[model samples]
Target: MKQTIPGLIAAIMALSSCSQRTTTTNHVKVKENPVNTKVTEQALDKGLFATLKIKNEFKTGEPVKLKFTVYNSTDSVKEFCKWHTPFEPLMSKYLEIKEANGEEAAYQGPMAKRMMPPPASSYQKINPGDSLSVDVDLLKGYAVQKPGRYTLSYTGQGMSGLVVKDSVVFHILP
Candidate 1:
């Protein structure tokens, strides 16, 4: 009976801690001011990550296809909202694209106004050591008119607790 009591207590503790999204840590605690949490993008879980990839180059007015993948390297399953991601139709401009001169490419896609805590249908699940990918054409959303090198990244909060590594570069020909 004594051993059973300790095992039960441990089980309860594990279950209780599984559903929490925020934790208290000196530099990583949830901020009292919501505005300060904007920088929390840098504080996302390292276990879940996103990456952007593109082809070598593109011609002016050609399709600049982008391949975005979300990887779950942890032992547990991870989930993220697919609303602002490429898994859905291009309804919102969630990508940040910059020209070679550092000017942001204008977003020419439709803008969608959403409510907080998105609908349950907007979520996607990825299992451990698995990845989900979606390919989208940048030309359909952002105005990639300039013929030069450009950097593309997933800056949207689609996958709630993951950081997107901005390392994709592509060039456009005149």
Candidate 2:
């Protein structure tokens, strides 16, 4: 019976983990357009990681919407500056989108001047195992109206205090 207890506990733990699924929970950053969306990212390291969620496809002229989510996977709370992320009003473009052929989309947004040591208002705190998300219309800052497969990633040239280690790829159907 010694082995039976441990085996039963492990079985239950496995089943519980398998039951959890991606969702738009109360922690949802925004719900401007509540279409079905799911976790589109996988972590590249421990501590904190970022993910971009987008539809697998879109129609030309339609809003190429994106959801930027930052998850804290560690046991402690973490905070970071929100600059260059969708968490704040986007004055400067922060994403680099490229076509399948490696052509980069042009930026046509206004760039804002930030004061040294971004004010406390510019930071966000995420609790352990919790996530924060924000919605941004990709087209608002980038000229990406063409219908084609495009890959989007954080430029890493000063995009928030956290690094977006993962990216997402989607297609535009004309």
Candidate 3:
């Protein structure tokens, strides 16, 4: 009888855990809708410019690739890097980043490691009339699937704040 009671208790505990695991309630309140982000053209090709172009419109859980082009007509070579920021502007006010395919996206590392130092930016040098290309993996952790417009920009860490020489607006439809 003692052995049977212990087994029964274990079974009940297991059942309780299983039930709690899938107890997802849809009573969570919804957040306010986001605002539209403005898209502007930067003549980096003419002077110092950066551009982000995707192969196609992105969708939730859809595999995609982004092509970034940095054009520097200046005397010095411009540097560039990539980032996935989802919380800025709270959406509607500006383009924001969100999880894609139900997964968070960003270079996994410490803040110092992920963000480059001023003048020692993420991108390398792009000399006069020179252009640089980078391929971004849309899977394996880094993706945004909220289905909205996003601004992918090249920002350089500067003394004042950040220098955004160029940017592009892309859309992801649900």
Each prediction's TM-score versus the true structure: 0.70, 0.70, 0.40
Candidate 1: lDDT over CA atoms?
0.68
| lDDT on C-alpha atoms for all candidate structures | 0.68, 0.69, 0.40
- The runs of at least 3 residues in candidate 3 whose Cα sits more than 4 Å from the true structure, single-residue gaps closed, are 1-47, 75-110, 113-123, 138-143, 146-167
State candidate 2's TM-score.
0.70
Please write out the lDDT profile of model 3 over residues 60-92, one tens digit for every residue.
777656554444444443343223211121111
Tens digit per residue, CA lDDT, model 2, 1-174? 998999998766543321212322344232232222332334323345677788989898889999888776655566666777788887887898999999999989889975555566767777656688888888888888888999998863243545566678999998
| lDDT of candidate 2 at residue 146, scale 0 to 100 | 86
Q: Which residue runs does candidate 2 get wrong by more than 4 Å?
A: 1-46, 157-159
Q: What is candidate 1's CA lDDT for residue 30?
A: 26
Candidate 2 local distance difference test against the native: 0.69
Model 3 lDDT at residue 3? 93
